[model samples]
Target chain A: MKIKLVFVSLVSFVAIAFLIYQWWPSPERAIKNRLGGLAKTLSVPANDGDLGRVTRVAELRHYFAQDVRVRAGASGPEITSRDALLGLIGAWTPPPGGWTIEFVDVQVTLGQQATSARVYLTAKVSGHDARTSEPTLDAREANFSMAKQDGDWVVTSVEAAETLQRPGSQD
Target chain B: MKRLLFGSNARLSLLRAAVLVVTAVVVFGYVLLPVRLQGISMLPTYRDGMLNFANRAALWWREPARGDVVAIRMAGPRVLYVKRIVGLPRERVEIAMGVVIVDSVPLIEPTVVYKAPWNLPAFTLGDDEYLVIGDNRVMAMENHDFGRATRDRIVGKMLF
Candidate 1:
């Protein structure tokens, strides 16, 4: 009876430990949380004041690395530095209905060293057309390369993943 | 009522419930991926907010044939595009006045209800490449998401 009790305790302890490990904050989870925060920050409210807009855009710098590279589209121009990206973001204007940005289907692959990760996700943006005032929803796949910097995951590079290539275009 | 709900033994009933849940997760998550249509890209045939299933095992026996409405996976499977296959592998595909031409032959598309006068230069698809486009041609060619997708990107065929 004593032996059976010990065996049951051992199994229960192991099962609890395994569950805890699975629930613990992992690198992938950290990166996903960071990306989620980034999405929330990127979303704009229609009634946002000028101060809120500037503050939100300024907060974007914390999510990116200093030497971050951003490519909005396959053919779009690349932004080399975080400052440049923030500058463009500050100058951006949202429609009357504002913009909602969400990152879904986020898949994170950790690097061999565990200090770096590559995230593949679909960026869904919903807003109103500036000219027509019609609601528009656009989704595109994007890749984000991030590294652990000062105990935070900071995006180092971002590129839009174009699943289909344009006709007659040579890349 | 209690016996009918929990069977003769509680442990056996719990085991059966677990098995049913596992089987459902495997079947729906992998075999038949449930997808909700989002945009007007595939108008007329599949409207917005329509629920459909993509059979991941549909192309197991044969390659994807032309005119098959397939799910085009983006980076991962979380989000995908539903498009109709037009140009097969190694075929030259071009859009002249919104009519798709394959190898200098005007392809007949029955699902396309509206056609925009869109012109695209002819381009030859590489090996294992298939051209995919939405059914709605009313939208401008530049605004629509249609182009050459690789074989690996074609996840599965749509099951209406």
Candidate 2:
């Protein structure tokens, strides 16, 4: 009877330890949390003040590395440095109704060293057209390369993965 | 009444409940993956905001044939695109004035109600690639999403 009780206690302890290990914060989870914060920061509110807009744009620079590469779309211009990206973001004006950005179906694959990760996700932007006030939703798949920098994940590169190929384009 | 609700014995009742839970998990999580339609890409055949299931076991026996509507997974299974297979593997596909040409032959599509003057040069699909497109050809080619998808990216065929 005593042996059976000890075995049961051992099994319970092991199960609890396993559960805790599974629930502990991991690198993948950290990257996902950072991406979520980025999406939240990218969303623009219609009633935002000029100061808030400037502050948010400045905050966006922290999400990327100093030499981040950004390719907006298949044929869009590429920004080679974080400063260039910040310049574009600061100059862009939101629509009349503002817009909300979300990242869905995020799948993060850690590199062999675990210091870097590759994330594939769908970037969804929902807003209203300035001309017609009609609601518009644009979703596209994007790939992000990130690395651990100063104890936080920072995006190093971004590339849009187009689902459809354009005419006369060989890819 | 209690015996009828559960089983004759406690052990049997526990076993029955466990079996039921396992079956539910297997059937729903693996066999029939629930999908919610979002866009107007499949306007005529499947409207927006429709709930459907993609049978993951549909292609277990044979490869996907032409006209089979499938769910193409992007990045992950959480969001997928519903499109019909038009060009088979290793076949040349083109869209000239919105008419799909497969291997220089114009393929007949009874589902497309409206046709636009969409043009795309002929391109051959790879061995493991399948070309998919929506039934709503009325939309501009530039606006629509249609192209070659690898075999592994296809999640499953739609089960109505």
- Best prediction by TM-score: 1
Q: Which residue pairs show collisions in model 2?
A: none
Per-residue lDDT of model 1, residues B3-120, tens digit only = 9999898667867897999899998999888988888989999988789998999988889999999998886776788999999988988888989999999999999998999998
Stretches off by above 4 angstroms in model 1 are A1-21, A127-136, B1-4, B7-9
Q: How accurate is chain B of model 1, given as a TM-score from 0 to 1?
A: 0.94
TM-score of chain A of each: 0.82, 0.83
Give the distance in Å from residue B110's predicted Cα in candidate 1 to where it truly belongs: 1.1
* Interface DockQ of each model: 0.66, 0.51
Candidate 1 residue lDDT tens string, A28-78: 888888999999999998867789789998889899999999998877999
For candidate 2, lDDT tens digit of each residue in A112-171? 999999999988888877886767677788999999999889999999997654435664
* Global lDDT scores for all candidate models: 0.89, 0.86
* Model 2, position A139: C-alpha lDDT score: 77
lDDT of 1 at A115: 99
Clashing residue pairs, backbone N/CA/C < 3 A, model 1:
none
